[model samples]
Target: MKKKFLVMSDSHGQNDLVQEVIDKESPIDGLIHCGDMEEAFGKDLSFPMYFVKGNCDSRRIGKKIPYERIIDVCGYKILICHGHLYHVKYSLQDLINEGISQQVDIICFGHTHIPLITKKKGILLLNPGSLAFPERGYQNSYIVLTFSENGIHYSLKEVMEY
Candidate 1:
């Protein structure tokens, strides 16, 4: 079976925006929030969600979210993290090392507010950017991933496009 996932990150405190995304991307098999989400925003989710704590995550929500986690879906190992621990703003090397150390096939992280999808060495690296405050000339964006026995397929979608 194929699994569809909606991936978002750096929502910060924009509940309305998050709600908008959720409503637009409904009927998804899973959801992923890379980090910096407010506690209240994550409480009422209706789908299976994998959440990580961001550097900007509030103290109240800090203990509630995990800093990092590994999720297995469709025979693929995915590493989800906030990217601060690996200093993503500086370079992707540390993040790559962490992925290799964990033996994951994909690494998903957010911190620079820049949307990106690339293959580093052999592992896939993805950053869906900030849905609330995007930087680096990038628009507010998210990702939709389809995972199956063949591999992981993904596409970047702008917030305005639904």
Candidate 2:
């Protein structure tokens, strides 16, 4: 069996880009919005979605919204966060430490506006970057993670057609 998920982050205030990605990558098992969404776009999605509150998300959005989430898919544990709390701009050590403590298999976050995928201390760390406001020279993109009996695989997909 193969389970696939679409992962994104740092939309900031642009829900249009979010829609674009969803339209392009439908039929997925689930969608993971790392953080920094503007509105209630999750309601419009066709598939199940996991969302976290980013630094920019105001309390007005909801008192129940959480800053982090843990999801299990195909026996893989995934941690989703916005990265501001972990100081991702400077280093991934904070995030890595959290994953270690939590005993998660994957850590996904955004905030540096840079796309990254790496394995640290046997844990997979992913930053899908910003679909709306990518860093200079970086393409607007997201990630997809596929889990199978064999193992897990990932890919970085550019959202910008150009």
Candidate 3:
């Protein structure tokens, strides 16, 4: 069986934009939010969703949401985080080390609001950027991952402007 997931991050209270992305990418098997989703907590969606708390998230809500999560998707282990705890803005070594320790195949994080997809030491690192506030000249973006018997394929997608 093939499974598809939508990955996004740094929404920062823009629930409307988040909803827009969910609507645009309907039928996905799951949704992953790397966080900074100030207003997105408790919002309902059609698909199964996983989330981590970002630095910008309120302390009250942060208590309820986890700082990181590990999940299995079609035999692939994925780690999701907001990246603040790992100090991603400085370097990925911390995050990389964490992934290694956790034995995850992929690590999804958001903080810089810049989209990125890279591999280090056999682990895939993906940042879907900011759906509400992109930075460094990048447009609002996200990622779509397709997992199948063959392997995992991904696409970096830009949100369309109305």
Candidate 4:
């Protein structure tokens, strides 16, 4: 069996982008939202999504779907969170350290609206950033992770507006 994930974060209110990405991408097994997806958008998302609570997430949204501290994504045990709760950006090292302590194979987060994929102490850290408004000033994109029996590969796909 093969495993593939569609990852996005910080929609801020852009639900159409989510739909656009899903429609355009090939096959994907799951979805991960690093959060700040406004309530209006999150509710109507058509795929299975695991999300963390961003600082901007309202109490209502949090109450409806509490962010999971850890998850088993594909064959990998992952720590998933919005970086604000973990103090990212200024301290990615610290966040990675904590993920190591938690014995997670992958650490996924979003908050800085910048994409990053790096390894530290055997842990893979990934930030898909904002799929709606990328701070990088390029087009909005999402990271797709594909897992096979041999290994894992990732590709970033930008959404095209119709």
Best by TM-score: 3
TM-score for each predicted model, relative to the true structure: 0.93, 0.94, 0.95, 0.88
Q: What is the lDDT of residue 54 in candidate 3?
A: 91
lDDT of 4 at 1: 70
- True-structure lDDT of candidate 1: 0.87
Candidate 3, superposed: residue stretches over 4 Å from native: 60-62
> Residue pairs in steric clash, candidate 2?
none
Please give the TM-score that candidate 4 achieves against the real structure: 0.88
Ranking by lDDT: 3, 1, 2, 4
> Residue 9 CA error for candidate 4 (Å)?
0.6
Off by over 4 Å in 1: none
lDDT tens per residue, model 1, 59-149: 8575767899999887889999999999999999999999999999999999889999999979999999998899968899999998877
Collision count of model 1? 0
User: Number of the top candidate by lDDT?
Assistant: 3
Clashes of each: 0, 0, 0, 0
lDDT value, residue 161 of candidate 1: 51
Candidate 2 residues 1-162, lDDT tens each?
Answer: 987888999887778787888778776888888888856674555567898988888653565778999988888888999999999999999999999999999998998889999999999999998888899989898998888899999999888764
Give residue 140's error in model 2 in angstroms.
0.7
Model 2 C-alpha lDDT versus the unseen true structure: 0.86
User: Candidate 3's C-alpha lDDT?
Assistant: 0.91
